[model samples]
Target chain A: MPSIRLVDVTKRFGDITALDRVNLEIEDGEYVCVLGPTGSGKTTLLRLIAGVIKPTEGEIYIDGEPASRIPPQERNAAYLPQQYALFPHMRVIDNVAFGPMAKGLSREEAYEISKRMLEMTRLAWRMNSYPHELSGGMQQRLALARALASGAELLLLDEPLGALDARLRVELRYRLRELVKDEGLTAIHVTHDQEEAMAISDRIVVLRDGRIQQEGRPIEVYREPNSIFVANFVGGANFLEGFVHRRLNGSSIIQLRGGLRVRVLDTRFNLGERVVVAIREEATGIVPSSLKSKGGRGNLLPGRVRDISFLGSVVVYEVELVNGEVLNSKVPIQMDHGRFRVGDEVLLSLNPEHLRVYPYPPIGLYRELEAV
Target chain B: MPSVRLVNVTKRYGEITAVEGINLEVEDGEYLCIIGPSGCGKTTLIKCISGIIEPTEGEIYIDGELMNGVPIQERGVGYVFQEIALFPHMDVYDNVSYGPRVKGWDASRMRRLVDEMLNMMALRDRMHDYPMELSGGARQKAAVARALSSGSLLLLLDEPLGALDVKVRIALRRELRRMVKELGLTAIHVTHDQEEAMAISDRIAVMRAGRIVEVGTPQDLYLNPRRLFTANFVGEANFMVGEVAGSSGGEVEVRVNGEPIYSVRSSLLSSGDVLDGGRVVAAIRPEFVVMEGTDGMNSGFGGLTDGCGASWGGRVRSEAFLGSMVRYEVEADNGVLVAVKLPSLSVGSGFRVGSRVTLTFPPRHVLLYPYPPEGLERAISIE
Candidate 1:
């Protein structure tokens, strides 16, 4: 497996910058997910690494060797586009064996490899079926089998499971991870799905506006996002605008609007500095007003349940605070127990450790506030 | 406002039956969501109600008035397509005012109504910008504003928010619900997204193969789904084929591959209705299944025998980290692989692959169904 690296990479389409001074290093045999929204240059970055697009500046290296001079065919990387471009007229086995045949492998050898790959992708039974005859998931598996048959050291997957349904996506994600690990292939997957990236990636690189916003393990990125964009994009977070009141040992106490105080575990900002606290819905616990007498360790805000929504396994409660701020809390739906209904008085407590504090305001809000 | 009703609705396109004999009713001012996968007749149903397509055999009523002869323009209903279909050359203000202008409303009245809609959708600042200049979410809001400016009492939205991202979808879902309720307008939204349907709709009608599988409030549909299709499609479910063993106290005990699972009773099922030791299927949600280690000694066995839930032994196959919770795929010796989700904070990440664990699921959380339903096999085959 080859480790891929991009140093000071810059790409521009006319006057628009697609990638700006991007520096990324993917370790050998590591599953790295490049996550970004649509038109965020995620696909451009993958194409650059695959040698399909040349960077306007800087160089890309594979296994410590400069790869800019190499053509896509010689880059030893398999690129799977979003639309799983399987050969429409070819059968599943023929599509998978095309890669091996292109590399001058004997017909018998290519067929053997193709058969093994098809079996691995659970498409053995459909080997004789044409792409048009197979389901979407099966066609995608054929695409994957072809990519594997290419004998590439690094795999570039751009929204590999984007076209599948949710259940099929979940099942394919597990199977893809297993395939990558079993083959010890260095894979870089680009997608906008936070759940898919988190479920399959060993590490995630969150990109926005053609720049790296944050890069870390999925759990770490979700728990402690470095910027408001990362927090809001990765998961649903309720942003509370506040200013740091005091700095305790290894923590900061933030006083939000309406004098509601919240203790955050991070001390990245100085006292009296403006900050934003991102509290995930699942981390916020709702307690009865009568239990308000019992003090809690974390920050507590009094609010009224504005709406109660049941979403299968979880119940989401939208609480409107005294300051007119709305916060949501998600808890596992307990059918036997009585749930909190709308218009009920409730207290929402945020665990300091679960709270992630960012020094910057949200992207759009920042400009709006600055104008004021 | 009008309460819309469809009786024995059936639509056909040549040889294809687009909509089967489906009956549904939408109360006045109620937000109803028609949810299903692509080609499941959700959009066709919406078009039928919008007067775009006449049903092959059925009667549509609006406030007790038959709507078969109603033209598209005279239906007094607003329609929003999945694609914005905005007049790209027109500015935001003109786009919203087009409906009022076509109705020959005075300029002053049209301006006032359009302005109110723009403000409600939070598009006031972008009134001067063309459709292409606005973002996906902004364009969708603009389209909604235009649809509502006609003062239609009934609104039909066909995947209005399907093009936006997750964050924008959530925000717009809340906004749409608030706007619908605030205006006291009866609306039917067609979408394939379960979260969007659950988040905004007062009631959900889940469709399958052109037929209505289940219709209920989001809570009722989520909590007490009657059929296996409803249970699996509305949310995540682990289905296991088993045999009916016995019953007691509003519960039925099912035996699957020598493992007993307790399930709540359904009106379609009974103690004697299921032949003794007859084959059946049990569907359980991941949230209902709790994992306990063997070190707890009697803890695993005790929790099951206490009547709180049913317990079974399984080996952990893999764990997927999903932000707030870790989902584990466990393989039971009974030939069923079930998923269990545990809160990240409550459970330590120590379970290794192949480690045997016990899964406990409450009886109320289980949905029992007969084995091999007719249309269910077709659905699985399509998958």
Candidate 2:
């Protein structure tokens, strides 16, 4: 197993700096996902680690050895790009077996390894088929199987599962993690999907504008994002602009426009300090307006449902507060839960513990939330 | 107003059938989404509706008029594609006005129409910006405005949001649907994303193997699909092969892995043709699988426990946190891996990996279907 360490790495092209003083470390056999928006320089970081491109500044060490000048072929890192390539002349089985065979294994041993890898990828039935005969999804799976069979100590994958169907993607994520762990291989996967990154990664590195915004375990990042951009980019959250009005025991009351107020379990800000309260849609709850009379929660905002979208596992309700601020609350579907329709009066329940408080951005809320 | 009708439409390119014997009706002012895997003829069907390619057999009608020999320009239909190709040199205003200008319309009318299109697309502020300066979502909105400026009552969109970022795509799809509904235009959206189709369309049509498998409202298609292909395509379902054991009072018992599992008898199964010992399939959504922590010791299968349906013992193999929900893969005693999804708010439910648990599938939630003529693997395969 091999660990990777980058110290103050910076990559520049022409007048543009793709990476700015990036420092990161990957433990042996750990799965780390790099997630960001489109122009966030995710691909550039992957390329720098794979040795496809050299960093303009700082050093990269593989297992404590400076490897900035190492050629890609000599790095022994398997890189899988978005558009994967396969040997068109070789059958699926032969293509996968080529990796192990190149490592001096016998034909029988290589074929056995290839078969196991193909089975894990759900491509065992098509082992004898050529790459030309398979669909785009099948070909993508074949490429992934070949990558696993290569026996590389480190794997660099860029959107490896983007081409497969949603169902198959979920199934393969488990298999991919299991295979990586079983082989004790270190992997760094780059993706634009937040849910995929959250589901598969042991740790997530949130990158924005070629800079690391936050890095932590999935739950920690989701529950407590450090910045407004990280809060919005990783698992979208609803934002309410307010000012800290009063401080209590481990809590503060935030004053909003139109005389509305909400309590959050944070008192770090001074009184009258402008702040923004961010709550995940999943953290918000909804009930009938009639329930306001039998109210239980303290942070209840009465609103009218503007829209409802059924997303299979959960239904998202867009509520327009009386003050004209729209907030979304995602409720999980269950047989017992009451369903709300568009144009219905409802009460949105916000738990103080689930609300996150942040200082107002100097650049304004809209600019801070922009991915670019 | 225009409503499209296709009867036995077939398109063939020298023995390779792109679409075969398709029949569909799109009502006036209705939004219909055609969803299927790639290479499943979704694009071909949409192209036929747009009059880009003529059907080899059968008939196509628009607004009660035959359209077989009509040219695309004369069809009075708007088309938006996955790739946005606005005029590079022209600003947004000129690009949107190009449609009305080419129709020989006067300057006054063209200007008014372009303004309305720009306002509806929320692109009026950016009308002076060139294509290179606009974001991907804005550029797509401009293209849509250009398509709608021609006053076409029928809109055909093929993967219009496929090229944008995930967040932008989600936001734009809602805007597109709202605009189409606001204009009262009949729309046919073709996409490969199931959640997008479910959220934005009035109804969804599932196509496969050059043919339409099933069509229904999003709720109907998701909750109660009439075909096996529709269930597998529209959402995630856990399917188990079984043999019919008995039936009574709108319920059936199926023997799977030598265990009797109860399910609700579907109308197809209650047609009096299915008898005992017949091969069938039972499916349940992961959300319906109720799981609770067990004591790890011997536990007998029970018929009734806290209102939970048929109960079985299992050990959690893995768990994943997917934003709003938690998904667990549990390996049962009989070696069947079952997927169960629960809300993430249940943080202390204690069904961790390797924890013994009891899984219950409510009878009402279990759906019964006749086994397909092909094998189960091929039946659910996307390609």
Candidate 3:
């Protein structure tokens, strides 16, 4: 039996619908990351699974049995908020032991479990320190240790490292993932950070406006995003608005605005259907101006460089087409930095295989276009 | 003329020394960024330079004149704080015009200056909107315009985009750099984001513990970091402990554990300088390490065999997909884990965990640093 399961769950807050008929299954010892933007129902989904907030109309099952009657404390799950929320008056060791002690464990047992957890989190040296004396990262680790010491089968973390500095965040992400995997615990983490979700989760469920946008492995979601929003939000994408003109063998020719034609690998749409072709900036490359006259086969556009940004590891160039559409191209920073500048005309070639196409909903049609 | 200069500047608050004995020079129209972690004194340094706070010791000069005696208004410097302090009661036009008005400029001149500043900041369309009505990014741009309306030669920005979202931060960073460059304004921007500082600044000054640790162009800093802190802070690095085994011909072999690895030529250390077979830490960048099959036929560096040039064998322990690249954590024969970043396209399929792989780092990419700085472990522990 799976550790936790939610079937046809829908949550509504008055006139505002937060989650709409969402179904999810988390297996035993699986580390699942619930990823989405702010106010996108990620927290709500976690809350529902944790039994903190009852679903509006659905059944939540644990070990193949309905758990609707179970309260949060008896649900056998741990939920860690964005803030560590440790007791300000308690010392680090006491805070971690609180959960185990509340579960009726003896003082000796609770102390042993808390000490082991704290040691694993690298906070054993600071166990006697109060919450106020601990650093942000240390406090987060203490909260994690407390959650683990609670002896829950499932752990739910809401933006666990959101309050940490970049360096500390990076370090804690690896440590957190290691702890979860080593302890063989099922975890459902909620975060808006795409990189953090991708780095740590076995599978990611990207939520948007109370609905699941896409759920898959990090590579699957990144390489083949299901929608425009997924492509743009997962990393970053340069979107080109176009209509499908023809479907060739395994490839489709897209006719963009301003009479530009692009060959894309996606053939899910019929001819004459408007679609948006999205490509990651790193997938595009720049060629010399002289190469424009060579009559490239497909996926090549003539553009003038609008701006160039040197970002140590990579260089992002903004190129403006004759029709005024802007496209971004990223190259390795080791390449000649001065090779391209603002106002320089260049040819940009996009790999057809890397292009993702989604149906371009008409403007003023619905809010769905921007929701992805 | 030099745009700004600070000589042995120091600042203190009670027992805390925010900035200590800092010296820096910014050229005319140059964009310099001060980057560090929080409490690293980046903001204090910027404040001292912008005349927001007087340095406890040392002098600040702008265009070859002492700026200590001159008030902030007469220092000919523009300052933009992290928070957008626009006058909420006034319209955009009036707020932008306030700087010129306070400097005793006539109404006609102030109007012309405000109009030009608004147009330059791309706020001409919303000149009548109140401060609360503008977007976060737009408000920051307007604040910048207000600073520039008085024709200040130097601009100081303290965590200007610290509160914006990721997308807006990226867009505004490019726009901010362009606006500063287009107007030929010298800028000193303080930020905690290393990438942002690298993306916008012509030069960067990395600070740590109230001192400037390193100063160089972004490329220079990334390619050749002089200090251990700079190497780890600027980007990802794999530090491996090795020893100088021997030198054959022009190549130097550094034996790590039982496996021998070759390093690039270094004139800083001689045969006598290194204790025979003494250990050192080799810092290698993940980008430089190529998978065995990915490089194909060219397995050895510069056509040298016997692992003399640049090669190391490791077993892949874990791998993570980072959108553009796949980062692999490999446990080398030396038992040290090294991370190697390969372009996603280069590896047809991602490397599976526990796959034995041989990695190669080009000679130019490997940096050699002593195993732990002299007397630093004690100092770090004391804090």
Model 2: residues with Cα > 4 Å off, grouped in runs: A69-71, A125-129, A132-135, A335-338, B270-274, B295-307
In order, the TM-score of chain B in each prediction is 0.93, 0.94, 0.89
Roughly what TM-score does model 3 have, to 2 decimal places? 0.89
lDDT measured at residue B294 in model 1 versus the true structure, 0 to 100? 67
Per-residue CA lDDT of model 2 for B26-78, tens digit only, reads: 99999999999889999999888888999899789999899998989889999
How much lDDT does each candidate structure score? 0.83, 0.86, 0.79
C-alpha TM-scores of all predictions? 0.91, 0.95, 0.89
Ranked by lDDT from best down, the candidates are 2, 1, 3
Return the lDDT, model 1, position B297: 27
* Model 3 Cα shift for residue B65 (angstroms): 3.2
Q: Which candidate leads the pack in DockQ?
A: 2
Error of 2 at B264 (Å): 2.0
**Model 2: docking quality category:** medium
Q: What DockQ do you compute for every candidate structure? A: 0.46, 0.51, 0.44
Q: State the displacement of the C-alpha of residue A56, model 3, in Å, after optimal TM-score superposition.
A: 2.8
| True-vs-predicted CA distance for residue B358, candidate 3, Å | 1.1
TM-score of chain A of 1: 0.90
Candidate 1 lDDT over residue span B51-153, tens digit each: 9999999999988889997998988999999888889999999999998898899989888899899999999999999999988989999999989998899
